[model samples]
Target: MTAGIDLGHPQAQAIQSDEDVVRVRQLVRTVAVAARLSLVDQTKLVTAASELARNTLVYGGGGVAEVTTVDNGRRRGIRIVFADDGPGIVDLDLALTDGYTTGGGLGLGLSGARRLVDEFDIVTGSGQGTRITVIKWSR
Candidate 1:
């Protein structure tokens, strides 16, 4: 999260079921459109949101996604925070590796999501759960 930016009140969305993950994509797309993001940017943001939301659901044992619109004076953007209260990641480096997964997934979720968004922040530890924040700025 960037300091000094004005962020609107976040709209919370659940990340429990597979359906909830789909709804998170919709929520992000709506905010991305309102922020004046280009079509490509919007797609990228939505894809990132989907990946992160799934991680929250599968790995984090369900959580919430908070979608918000933000302004940094000149540009507008959408920011999403995915948080969960499950057991946190033990090895951050391995978790971020491109082909490593604790759940037999392809292991591209975190790394791929980082590449798709303009800004990405993740916080997790052994038992601290996980919180991932992604921001997509309008061009």
Candidate 2:
């Protein structure tokens, strides 16, 4: 959703296992740091990345993520994209509602991640797969 220019090449990784989720968190943290995000902001972005990566692996049946740095001219930011080709969410409204869980977890993955980021965008459908993009700007 950012019209901003890419600051560097995206660092991509497959989201196929629990370990990959951890790696996502680390990569996001690295970018957040490089963007000069505050410590709190860094934690929020990394947490969001963890949840989204987990969702990509579980609900999406594995996928890929790209973590990149972006600059909207005024400030630097960290952008993360999570995509999957599994069964797409049928009810996006319900999926985003807090406490709604289709995977038996706490149901905080999607909604919580949205709250943690400065910008959130998701493209999904019943059989169209899912692509989620989140960005957190450095203040």
Candidate 1 lDDT, 23-91, residue by residue in tens? 999999988888889999999999999999999999999999999888878788888899999999999
Clashing pairs in 2: none
Instruction: Provide TM-scores for the models.
Output: 0.95, 0.98
Off by over 4 Å in 2: none
Give the range of the ten consecutive residues with the poorest summed lDDT in model 2: 1-10
Give me the candidate number with maximum TM-score: 2
Give me the runs in candidate 1 sitting further than 4 Å from their true place: none
Best-matching candidate per lDDT: 2
Q: Candidate 2 on 50-84: residue-level lDDT in tens?
A: 99999999999999999889999998888888999
RMSD of 2: 0.7
- Where does candidate 1 have its weakest 10-residue lDDT segment? 1-10
Evaluated against the true structure, the overall lDDT of model 2 is 0.93
